[model samples]
Target: MATIRIGLDRLPPAARAAVEAHTGPLLTVEETAEGFNSEIAARVTSATGTWHIKGLRADHPRAWTQRREAAIAPFLTGLGPALRWREEVAGWDLLGFDVLNGRHADYAPGSADLPEVASLLCRLGETPCPSIELRHAEQRLEHYVVRPDLRFFAGPHLLHTDLNNANVLVGDHAAEGDRARLVDWAWATRGAAWLDAGYWVIWLIAAGHTPVSAERWAAEIPSWHTAPAEGITAFAAANANVWSEISTADPDPWTLRLADAASAWYAHRRTG
Candidate 1:
């Protein structure tokens, strides 16, 4: 479920003061609506520089997510937006990230951004999983997947399991390698190297590709080959179940789309 978004102006005076201490005078504040989790999401500019800020109240139920992102940010150099600073004051926990000059990746068929996304995933595969506390992929899907199939998800790999297109930013600047960068690390997991590729398959299907076509795109990531056929099948089925639950509870159009996509992939995996 989406959190009720609040503008920077609504922050307590102490919290606002703390943010200004880092940003200098706030020249502009553009509240963004792309993400679902953070109550405070916006881009701010000052005499110094620009930053994308996200925050939640210290007492919020999801406050831990801010800490998770902060903890995981250091190891994500070259893969995600750099975390510039973090503040906890006046009951709010906030993170400021270097602003990237880019747009959300388009997942539609034949989009040029596809190759860039694949390249990003390739780079991510080479990053070693940091020994920080993180969730295991199998444990997350334990309720939806057959217990015996959990072995397929066990591996010492850093996995950005959320493959939502909104989480990917692609810059056309060739000097910057034209790579798609990932954001939103609150749900980062430790899992089999291949699992992130599998996650992308569902998003591809949601973007209008047939299940076979989606799997073909997944193959672009080298780690996809490490996944056993049966394991992929199990993962597909489990995701179908997960999305079913998600859509049933929220019933949002995007959730329904992903649910349909997951089902389509599971059906294809079963018969193929």
Candidate 2:
């Protein structure tokens, strides 16, 4: 019998068997362009119906990474349909969901589904971060702060961290259903809520829409730099030494501009 390669070899035996049994005569298997994490998409046929199997790579040190989909699946079931099913015999973290039969980026700013997409993001943000150890807030500030080449904005909020457009899937639905669904949750992290917004803003600008110009983008940086100090004085006071290095790794021009703007804003606030 021919074998279906769904990349589930590392899952527990029960989970592996479940995938193999469900995915019969795997007609095709290939990697998906969804996220940075290793993911494989497989199409298989069975007596009951055809199925798509999404198997995440198990080669990472973080066990939580592999279980992310299953962890959030239950919470998102009613909010958005959840189609993930797994087996214990299989050693991989495999999730089987209905294959989306449409383009992922079809929905844009004016699309009727834009508000729903934003709403979904707001809801996802509401789901508290899992118990995985997060980088210390001060440490994050230190790493991104000191490099004279970058600027830092400090705040404590949960962020998706990576919500670029490609991760959003746009599909046709029944006349009254949601037309867009957001997927891929591997980079979820606890940070500034505006960090997610800022990142998406950059993505949108890079994609060629002029939502915020260079000047407005430049102006927002200083406001962010001053934000943490305004509300969380104690935290900012404690972390002041490390904040200087926070923006070091972020070499992107827009990020640098924002950092510069923030630095100027900080200086102005101190004097006035």
Candidate 3:
């Protein structure tokens, strides 16, 4: 799902006009090369202020992601970028957010950023799931988890299952603790409190953490410590299957790497 790279000037006239109404003529545009689903993704400087603008064509396969992000963003508290405004013009949907000035998080073992990531996970654990109906863990993983145990994944906690390092930002601007922010909420779910940490372990491995070290990182979140081992086992097996299917379907370098990581973590859990 490659997003079409588009700048402020690339937007349709109506869409461009709608955005410029809030932000004046774009003085500078810095386009982003990452993200799997966005036709327009960039940081634009205008007379008003800099805003991170992202959007997709109305009929694109992943167009709903922008809407989902906007719908759940307010409930995120401080977890992700604030959605200042949104608009649809010329068959494209767009969103504007206050640009965050932070580096993408480093997930390497022993990096100081891990603690901030853990802290953000802890903060999210405390956020009661919003009333918005979200996919339950069991439902979302139904195809992957063999003999799925509904009890193992039951809960009402909001879960940000996709914690890719790129979606996280860490910086030294905070008054005391490490400053970290989570983004890309399209895959956010409602599940047991421990599920997000469980998912992070896979990403940690993908970023070069041995399974033991990755589990150590997961342990930093209180929910991880208290999570039932059976639930963890279920999630591990399910995720391994999910990643395997993704790798098989795409076979892209990243998908292959993550498949291996998920398999490695599953093997670790099986042995210990």
Candidate 4:
């Protein structure tokens, strides 16, 4: 099967109109292939200065995007260079951020950097945000996770859920110890924190790791699982969902163990 590609011209006319309105004449439009959802990266001169435009398709209700951007924008602004402005028009969410010199997916994680990434996950998971209604988690688990029709796991928590290697961007001239920036917040959600950590850990393991690498990841799992029982259970279920889809090997051991653990944890939490 040919892989589906997201391109700039794929934007609906209404969405394009919105982008043109904010970004004057577009000097160039580059389709960014870094996200699960269809996204476009455009370079255009505006009244202020040159800007990077990220346009996202509205998969859910329009209000959801507005609410989500509003909820997380303040938190993400100073943590790293983030979207400076956002507008929803037609069936898309258009955002503008300063044009930073970098490319996504270039950061290669070393054994030493694994802990730092884990620590960053802890920071993101621990940070609190206003509770938003997460009706999608239940629907995702039911339709996608349990059914095994979809390979991706949709877990609970306000997770930057799609934090794979590709989503990370670093300067081309970045030194050895410079911090990397994270983009792509389309999959952000509220649920289990460990799900995000587990997702990365599992990906690292799948990317062909040595015994030492495996041991390091194994040791870090507990820290990711530090959330309360309910949160942990939700994360475990999310992990199982993703594993069922993308794992090359039979997921009997991991899936069964995770499912049992999640069930037991939830039951215990309910009783307590």
lDDT of each: 0.93, 0.47, 0.86, 0.53
Give stretches of model 3 more than 4 Å off: none
- Going through the candidates in the order shown, the clash numbers are 0, 31, 0, 8
* Order of the predicted models by lDDT, top scorer first: 1, 3, 4, 2
Q: Of the candidates numbered 2 and 3, which has the greater lDDT value?
A: 3
TM-score of candidate 4 to 2 decimals: 0.62
RMSD of 3: 1.4
Q: What would the TM-scores of all predictions be?
A: 0.98, 0.56, 0.96, 0.62
What is the C-alpha lDDT profile of model 3 across 134-196, one tens digit per residue?
778878888877655656777889998888898998878784344898878888788889999
RMSD (CA, Å), each prediction: 1.0, 8.5, 1.4, 8.0
Superposed model 2: Cα runs more than 4 Å off: 1-16, 23-31, 43-45, 49-52, 56-64, 78-83, 87-91, 106-116, 125-142, 146-158, 174-177, 211-272
Candidate 1 structure quality by residue, lDDT tens digits, 76-95: 98899999899999999999
lDDT of 4 by residue, 1-272 (tens): 11244566777887777777767756666555444443556655646467766655666433354455545656764234556677687777777767666655421336445554555565565566446654444454553334442223334445666556666555546544344555656556665445566456445544444323533553464545444544444444555544545433445654444344334433433454
Best by lDDT: 1
Pairs clashing within candidate 1: none
So what's the TM-score on candidate 3? Answer: 0.96
Q: Please identify model 4 stretches exceeding 4 Å from their true place.
A: 1-17, 43-48, 56-71, 78-81, 90-92, 105-116, 135-157, 172-178, 210-222, 225-243, 246-272
